[model samples]
Target: MASALIEEAHDLSGGAGDPLVHLPDTATALVFRTRADGRGDLVVVGPRTRAAYFAGKDLAVCVRVRLRPGTARPLLGVPISALVDRTTPLAELWGGAAVRLERRLTRLDGDRRLILEQLETALDARMRGPAVRDGLVGAAAMALSARGRERLSDLAPRMGVSERHLRDLLTEDAGLTPKSFARIARLRDALAHGGRSSGLAQLAAATGYYDQSHMTAEFRSLMGVPPGAFFAGRLPALQRC
Candidate 1:
């Protein structure tokens, strides 16, 4: 089923001059933008290694299709590693093929359902073609996304591959090394469980950190702020979008 290949497809509307913030995330997103002249543009937002800020003063409403791991290479026809921390137009990768899809989406403008359906259909078609991806790599990514406690080296033998091979494939397929992906996944879990716990220490313990200080160190490294500062909104720019 396509469920394993796609996570979610949704639309977002932003007011003029609005500021947006995104935390470190590993998922690759395919965003659809419709211009004022009734034409569509497809943008590929690669996996992010750090938090990013965007000031979209002249933004338009857009639809985003967030993809699951093991799906980007086949659907986009590129190595995921080449896309880390980068944003590219679909036309740059697929050339005329991308332009044709944009025209199709433009025709479906004002019909969000049709636009989304067309995107899915296009993805399904692309996925049926040849691709260089590893199912084991996808499995490793999912495992890390769930707990962030396993290592590629540890998972390699189970997947019937060498540790070095698994690590290399992971970087190529997921745009993040096993360790880096795990830390981001751990941070995601911290954010999720952090909302329920009253304090950082409790949240740390719940999310598999050695202690609060350890979690604080990771937060500073990945999020640019310690848990206390980030959670308490000590930095005005740290607001969640």
Candidate 2:
């Protein structure tokens, strides 16, 4: 099923003057940048180990589709493990083919629907990756992405595979160890509850921390900010590049 490999496509654009703050994320995404001059770039935003801050964009619009785990390898034409915590331009990997695709996109003049369709067609043409979909990795990733305290040791047995084998598969296809994926999933849950919760302590407990303190430490560790400031939109000083 498409849902197993593709998360949701999203429009990440904001006010032209507002800086962008991207929180830590567990998935890989195809970021399509459309600048004001009717030409731009298409880049792969690999998984993030921590939050990232970007200066305001002069681009007219930006859209992204977050690909589910276990689905990007064929499209990338490289081992997923190589992309961890890195951003790469498609041209570096796809070469002239990538350049030709950009020319096609530039000719579209930034029409959102057309741009998305073009990208989708290109992905659909990939015979193995997203099209056929990797069953074992997909199932394992979904289980871990549920944000529960599911141990790989327990999951491995249920799936009829050794824990080491499962770990290796995910590390290669998902570009993250089982433990790291789980941590990001929990952070995602916390973010979903950020604005709706009555208080930070309650939110932390609800999202699976031992207590507020445990949650605070993780927030700092992965996102470089305490939950309070993160939820309040008051990020600490970060060197924006």
Candidate 3:
């Protein structure tokens, strides 16, 4: 599981520009945002295939908990596929539980650590529930994120599953096909070294892309901008949930 984050944007008042964020392929985020007027909202951000624009209001505080791949479906009580490329209010999914959580958060004082602890506890409880674990999905995600590029066809036989079965498992658990997940894994690996890459060609080679053009096309399709624009600081820095 990704670590929880509590971000306070006290400086952002009166609608400051929010940065564009590229959500990762393997996780979903549960975000709780509170504005100056004491209005709080809860949202579940599903796996995003593209970059998203977000900004905070003045004196706003945001708390986020990121759920690991294949875990959100059980916690959210719905298939991850239902949430792909969308953000839905927590109330719509969790109903009264969402309301109770918001109320508890609103009543708390400005203790970021405490807030994070509470959120983590909530997630822990959900994870400990009767959710069936899919080891194959987790293994597939690990393989995709590993140092070397792995072909799904080859990986499937090694995992003792057929290629079609592997695809179905990934779709049900990760909300993505094997090919798409691998693409995202490669993209993330490249972006992690964005600050130090000598050039596009070098980045492409290091990230296992066919070439610079292949990397650029994937970057543009997923990030809404080319590598040049993204690395130039035109887009907002990615905030991991």
Give the lowest summed-lDDT range of ten residues in model 2: 125-134
**Highest lDDT model number:** 1
Instruction: Estimate, for each residue in 1-241, the C-alpha lDDT of model 3 and write its tens digit.
Output: 3342211211122344556354455667787778657877778878777776455334456666666555677778777778888889988888998888777776776455666666767766766765645568767866865778588988999989999987887788768877777778888888898889999999999889999999999998888788999889787554533
Residue range 124-188, candidate 2, lDDT tens digits: 66634344233667688779879666799999999899999999888887788888888888988
lDDT preference between candidates 1 and 2, better one? 1
TM-score, model 1 to reference: 0.88
Evaluate model 3: give its lDDT: 0.72
lDDT of 2 at 13: 58
Among the numbered candidates, top TM-score falls to 2
lDDT of each: 0.79, 0.78, 0.72
Residue-level lDDT of model 1, residues 1-241, one tens digit each, is 2466678887765555565657788889898886666568799989988776555534355888899887887788878999998889999998998899988988874577888888888887888887545587678778767764666667778888898988887788888888888888888899887768988888998998899999999988887778887777554352322
Backbone clashes in model 2, listed as residue pairs: none
Task: Report backbone clashes per prediction.
Answer: 0, 0, 3
TM, every model: 0.88, 0.90, 0.83
Ranking by TM-score: 2, 1, 3
